[model samples]
Target: MVKGCSLSQNGSSSFPDPLLYRQLVGRLLYLTNTRLDISFVVQQLSQFMASPMINHHKTLTRVLRYLRGNPGQCLYYPENSPLHIKAFSDSDWATCPDTHKSISGYCTFLEDSLISWKSKKQTTISRSSSETKYRALALASCEIQWVTFILEDFQLHYTQPALLYYDNNSVRYIATNGVFHERTKHIKIDCHVVRECLQKKLFHLLPISTHD
Candidate 1:
């Protein structure tokens, strides 16, 4: 999908064949398992599978064109790369014009190689940008925990906590501090998970500039 392009169910022109749209999107969704670059766009297009519009079809064609232009693209892991796990979490708050739900995205790397990533809509609506960000952090924490477990099974262990980078300072503070506020009450339970992960040294939450 193009940057800053937003799609919704409210488009004026509907596609002629919903069946064809669903078939094409289903294939693209399968492709995302190995093609992380298309994951976000695939998620957005999958949302309209039930009733795609003409504009949605055009968007899907663009994705296909992008793929055709980069047929050799694939993830590569060098044999000598380090095994340390690092993650970056981010979210677009209330971005869905229809449901008002945020979109959460994260990418995990083993050294310099990208191993796991996701882009999905949140299950619940968040009242603030911080809440949405914290939710994304929580999700990333879960993913990191899973990755660590898998590594442990492979007899690989890290001496330090996995580094989790985020662009939201409020989320970093909420994960480290024990204080709670009225604005954050609804999200306290989610925040607690991240706090517990921190206390156990599962991961270290840090703030970074958005451009990085």
Candidate 2:
């Protein structure tokens, strides 16, 4: 998908054959298991499978061209890679022009290798960017838990805290600050998992620049 591009369900001429669109999108969805780079675009494109537009198919073809150019791209799990878990999370606030809902996405890495990831819209409207980010953080926190548990099952452990990076400064302050504030009350429920993970030293939250 294009940067800052938000596709709407309505408008544009509908594709003549929805089956072809569905088949192409389905194939792309399967590829996302290893082709993490195209996950976001594929997710966006898949939404219109039932009734794709010419614009959507054009975007899909663009993705196909990019994939053809990078045939060797893949997730590599090296034996020398450490077992530490690091996660990155972000949200596109009010990304959906129609519904005005946000989208939260996250990726979990086992040391230097990307092991798991996701890109999906939020379930509810976020009142602030902080809330959107914090919710994303919570989702990432859950992924970290599963990663750690699975690592433990394999008798592997990293003593250091699992590092979580997000681009929101408000999330950093909200997660770190214990003080109760009226501004944060509405989002208190969403912050619970993240704060608990912090208290237990499960994750070390870090704020990053989106531009970076």
Best by lDDT: 1
RMSD of 2: 1.9
**lDDT tens digits, residue span 1-212, model 1:** 77798899986599999999999999999999899989998999999988899999999999999999999999999989887889999999998989999999999999899999999999999988999988998899999989999989988876678999998767777777677433477987777778888989998787775553
Candidate 2 clashes: the total is: 0
lDDT per prediction? 0.89, 0.85
Per-residue lDDT, model 1, residue 85, is 86
The regions of model 2 sitting more than 4 angstroms off are 180-182, 209-212
Stretch of 10 with least lDDT, candidate 2: 179-188
| TM values, all candidates | 0.94, 0.92
Best candidate (score: TM-score): 1
Residue 140 Cα positional deviation in candidate 2, in Å, after optimal superposition: 0.7
List RMSD in Å for every model shown. 1.7, 1.9
Which pairs of residues collide in candidate 1? none
